[model samples]
Target: EPEVTQTPSHQVTQMGQEVILRCVPISNHLYFYWYRQILGQKVEFLVSFYNNEISEKSEIFDDQFSVERPDGSNFTLKIRSTKLEDSAMYFCASTNTRDRDTFGSGTRLTVV
Candidate 1:
């Protein structure tokens, strides 16, 4: 089965620095998204992108976060400035239709 793929499986960063999380969604998928789970906390929605524009975003996706589809297959989330609270497992998901979404294993971000 095809799946969304995330790179750097894990990343260690310093506070106040920038970090880019990368993902490659399934070839045929049309919608892509980013979500994060802060350790034991529930998974929180960050942003969604479709047709090369942001379809929707949550409050957590403030000035600190941005999403982009640099090419046809790659989707990226950039954190302009990292914070301790930003440390989490960030997941990438994609789907061609609302009923079927595939998620990557996730990239774990550790802020030190």
Candidate 2:
């Protein structure tokens, strides 16, 4: 099985600050996505990228959030300003087909 790598297993940030989460999907994957899970809540989709452009994004991915696929290898998620409500476990996922997906361990974001 291949792996999706995410950096900074944990992140601590202050409210109103900016932060960027990084991910590297499997080399062969063509689809990449960002999802967030609150401590006790279900996973929520943030954005999806394919062919270097954003394919889809959820309402939760508002103006403050952005995704980028730079150099055809790294997939990144950036939050312009951190909020207490934005603190969660952010996961990076990738898939070559609709059958299955591979996810990274996730970055635990803590806001103060």
Candidate 3:
């Protein structure tokens, strides 16, 4: 079965630094999304992308955060500046239909 893949399974960064997490979703899937789970917290939706544009975003996806599909197969999440609170497990997910989603093993971002 096709699944989402995330690189650098874990990352550690200094505060105020920039970090980009990468993902490649199932080829046939259309909807893409980024969600994050703070340690001990529930997963929260960050942003959703479709047709190469942002379809929806939550308050957490502020100016400092951005998502892009530089190439048809790669989806990326960039945090312009890291903060202590930014440490979390970020998940990449994609789905062909609205009913189900396949999530990548998260990229754990740790801001020091």
Among all candidates shown, the one with the greatest lDDT = 3
Candidate scoring better on TM-score of 2 and 3: 3
TM-score of 2: 0.97
In order, what lDDT does every prediction score?
0.95, 0.94, 0.96
Superpose all Cα atoms of candidate 3 onto the true structure and report the RMSD in Å to 1 decimal.
0.5
The regions of model 3 sitting more than 4 angstroms off are none
Task: Name every residue pair that clashes in candidate 1.
Answer: none
The C-alpha local distance difference test score for the whole of candidate 1 amounts to 0.95
Task: Give per-residue lDDT, candidate 2, residue 96.
Answer: 89
Q: Give one digit per residue, the lDDT tens place, for model 2 in 1-112.
A: 6799999899999999999999999999999999999999999999998888999999999999998886788999999889999999999999988559999999999999
Per-residue error (Å), model 1, residue 20? 0.3
- After superposing candidate 1, which stretches have Cα over 4 Å from the reference? none
Candidate 2 Cα deviation (angstroms), residue 55:
0.8
Clashes of each: 0, 0, 0
Name the runs in model 2 displaced over 4 angstroms. Answer: none
Specify the poorest-scoring 10-residue window by lDDT in model 1. Answer: 94-103
Ranking by TM-score: 3, 1, 2
User: What CA root-mean-square deviation does each model show from the true structure?
Assistant: 0.6, 0.7, 0.5
